[model samples]
Target: MSTSWRIRIMLTIHAKLVEAMLAQAHKDHPFEICGVIAGPEKSNLPLRLIPMRNAAQSETFFKFDPQEQLQVWREMEARGEEPIVIYHSHTHTPAYPSRTDVQYASQPQSHYVIVPTDPAYGEEIRSFRILDGMVTEERIRMINSYKAEWELSMEAMVA
Candidate 1:
């Protein structure tokens, strides 16, 4: 018998971002809302929030508009950024990844966040990592604000 242990992953993001996503989810209601959070390449920091149009406009599925997705990717490349977090909402289900979500996850590095808009689910939001058809739930650490390294350095100098 083989026993395998996996390390739990944690995603640290700004509380304001979470609030913004939740607000969007609520506004969308029955339909799903999808978006990406871009950050410095390999930084794993979700700094720039970009709410995208769901081409599918579905209650149980989400597909980003191809044109908008292309534009966003191009802009991220130009800014030396990458999609660090890919998020969407569930209208009537829990904030958990569905089989379709796992099948469609293309970015292995992105933190997949799901916000449940169903009243029964309350405000529980969840994050996960979907790679190679495996879903690993991650703990979210929400901070009031996220200061970049440069900002922190500048603050130290001012102090």
Candidate 2:
């Protein structure tokens, strides 16, 4: 496997996970929510949800609770997993990344998922690959199950 990340211009994630994240975002309402969907390290698959507390607790921004983040990261490491998707909600803002988000993005390989609690957009969830300050929007193929998604990906790889 290549040590360097292979960035995808598009991705497929479970609609269930998307629904869960959107619910979390709505629950957090005016406050931004954040989390990670982790999978086997280097799998390029986001297989589970790990909703995180926004330490900032601001409507306009989000910051992971330092302790929670530390614990989560360690747990994923122990499970031989890495964050395949790093996600956050934007309350009262567009689903696009903010200037600060662009500056703070540290995961070039992980899909940066955004859930906007803007009722105007009906809480549409979007994904992007944010690398070196450049944010490239990605296609999100919502699937019913991760297994189905994984099998398709494997077939694509084989083809």
Q: Which candidate has the highest lDDT of all?
A: 1
lDDT of 2 by residue, 45-79 (tens): 78889999999999999998989999999999999
Q: How does model 1 fare in lDDT?
A: 0.86
Instruction: Judge candidate 1 at residue 110 and give its lDDT.
Output: 92
lDDT of every model, 2 decimals: 0.86, 0.85
Best by TM-score: 2
Provide the RMSD of all predictions against the true structure, rounded to 1 decimal: 6.3, 3.4
Q: Write the per-residue lDDT of candidate 1 for residues 1-159, one digit (tens) a residue.
A: 111111125677898999999999888878999999998775567889999999998999999999999999999999999998999999988888999999999999899999999878777889999999999999898888676533543444455
Mark the 10 consecutive residues where model 2 has the least summed lDDT.
Answer: 1-10
Off by over 4 Å in 1: 1-8, 148-159
Cα lDDT for residue 46, model 2?
84
Q: How many angstroms is residue 18 displaced in model 1 relative to the true structure, after the best TM-score fit?
A: 0.5
Which residue pairs show collisions in model 1?
Answer: none
Model 1: lowest-lDDT 10 consecutive positions: 1-10
TM-score (C-alpha, index-matched) for candidate 1? 0.87
CA lDDT of 11 in candidate 2?
70
TM-score, per-candidate, Cα-based: 0.87, 0.88
